[model samples]
Target: MDNKIRLFTGGTQPTSVGPFAVNEAEQVETRPGNRPSPRELHVTGTAEVSYPADRASVRLSVGNNKTTVNEVTSSVSRRLEYILQAVRQHGVREEDITVRKFLHRDQEVYHMNAEVTVTFSDFDQMEHACSVLLEKLDRSVSVGQPRFFHSAECLNRVRQSACVSAVENAQQKASRISQLLGQSLGAPTLVREDETREWRSHGEDDEEEDGGGGRRGQEAASTQVTPLPRIPSVTASSRVSVYFRMRDGNRKKY
Candidate 1:
């Protein structure tokens, strides 16, 4: 029924005798059998690299309402033609632009909608595309922000970089520990790791692109189109567990 003894670091063990606590016993008994043993060191290391995305995906949606389904579809087509022309003028490959979905429905009234998507391999060309599409089309079209992704080659590089950093970090820690305890550190007996991932975003506008573009109010005056900035950085990290064998019967210093 005594909480004091239960809460002690040594708990209710028989050797709860002041300084001769569980910690001391653990150290004293560690080498009792005199068998070679190793100490574990756990630490984290991170590596990051930036590379331009290889591909970009953008979504464009056009909608129209008319008295009949036939009238709605024609209006949608007209709007799409302008957008398609704008995309071509901005250097987008014809094969890269494709319609993802098209629909015409009548629920008492007529409604039509079409979803168009474009893929780009060049970052500079992709940025100015949206504005070009907007300008060429007489009717308004909703454009979604672009999505960017690194190629497989970039991902492989990041993984290799992070693994190297983690090993170096572990070795550095082992050497420091050995020096503090007046002991020599042996080669690493084991190496393991934990993993993490990170993503970053960046944006570039037209006025900022050519160094002479303007805000929305200046759209009419601006001839050079501005493209959204490309996000080019991704990070992957790993933590290592390193074990170093002890030289003699003495426990390695903390």
Candidate 2:
């Protein structure tokens, strides 16, 4: 006994059908409405834009270790107060200053630390503040390196411009590729951003100290002989990716 079954499409006389198992004949029916897949092209585009820094930040620290907590706290507070006064005199606004305090107990000694962060929109004012602090403050007070950065508005504007440029770049690339293949680029069927990357450059200078006695004399003499260091400029950058579709010459717009 033969055990073969034949599949047919709309009574087409079996049309050289493939052999099927007896139990699988119901699942082998052919339909006449299947459609072919559409053709597509894939490409990626990227762009980068840079913006200058419009703001600066500096962190200053004061600390003291004494036998009693009150003693340590008072010392740190006094130094911090003087530092804040000097900062404000240099044109830094009170709202732009942030303060933090920490206390720790060690064997037979109490330690108190205070940190003040000042942000400035003007580079000249920031430099003057740092110089004043290093020149008049006590040795116990330490000034950190100034950090430059872009404002929020600047960053947003640059990112938007970069993304737009990237899309334009993608369209130009697709048009050129389609032209080489004798086809014309059509409207974008899909647009996707692969990822966005941000780049920032931070500049740091060596810390300056208010030398005491002989050290101060040496620094004063050196300042007369050495040129001032140049302040570094902060740079912010953005990148993006884009995709577009391709069309035939009959539908080409140009």
Candidate 3:
């Protein structure tokens, strides 16, 4: 048997189709289920405020070397007791004084050391206490410079005020930018606080305290004592980023 091949042909060719026409309204309208994208503006603002220090801390150390630990310990304890008593007479509370460090190292001569800290809210009292310790205590006792800083309540209050000012600054910036674009600023879409910064500086009036009458005058008259240096003020700053919606005056809302 011989293999045979058969070919089949259609009677009419298919008609060529042209591109569909789009009306003006259909071209401009968005897809029925899709929502419009949001419009927003971002701006950053910063603010800072300074406050005087309300607290001061002083560190003192007592150390001695002797042939035996008992002798050194006894000597250090007696000196510390006298120092504490002198400090308390100037209004330092027992709770505000703390033993910060104690160390003992064995050697040919037994060495012992103890550190104490005193905190004060009143500068006059602090000055008086420091003067008494320096004039009356043994030379072995060392006094460190006082460190001044704002209290926790003061820091928190200043920080909050700075944040509020920063936000207001961001809003004003956004409003100006929106006006330039022939649009108005709507409600803020997002707000975030940025990293905060702080700085410290000695205030000008810090030296004036030494010249005034009080503990300063008494110390000046008797021993020609140098007035304690003025405490520095602390400045706190905050930054914030804000995103606000924009509304066009001529455009209708969706």
> Which has the greatest lDDT?
3
Q: Put the candidates in TM-score order, highest first.
A: 3, 2, 1
lDDT of each: 0.60, 0.65, 0.71
Off by over 4 Å in 3: 1-48, 100-108, 161-198, 202-230, 237-254
TM-score of each: 0.46, 0.48, 0.50
Model 1 C-alpha lDDT per residue in residues 10-68, reported as the tens digit of each score:
22222232321222222324566674333433333444444556778888999878888
Native-to-model Cα distance after best TM-score fit, residue 156 in candidate 2, in Å: 2.6
> Candidate 1's C-alpha lDDT?
0.60
lDDT of 2: 0.65
Where does the lowest 10-residue lDDT sum fall in candidate 2?
A: 18-27
C-alpha RMSD (angstroms) for model 2: 15.6
lDDT of 2 by residue, 75-187 (tens): 88988999898888878888999999999999999989999999988888788877777787758878886667777887887777776776677677766777887866545
**Looking at candidate 1, what is the lDDT of residue 188?**
46
Model 1 TM-score on a 0 to 1 scale: 0.46
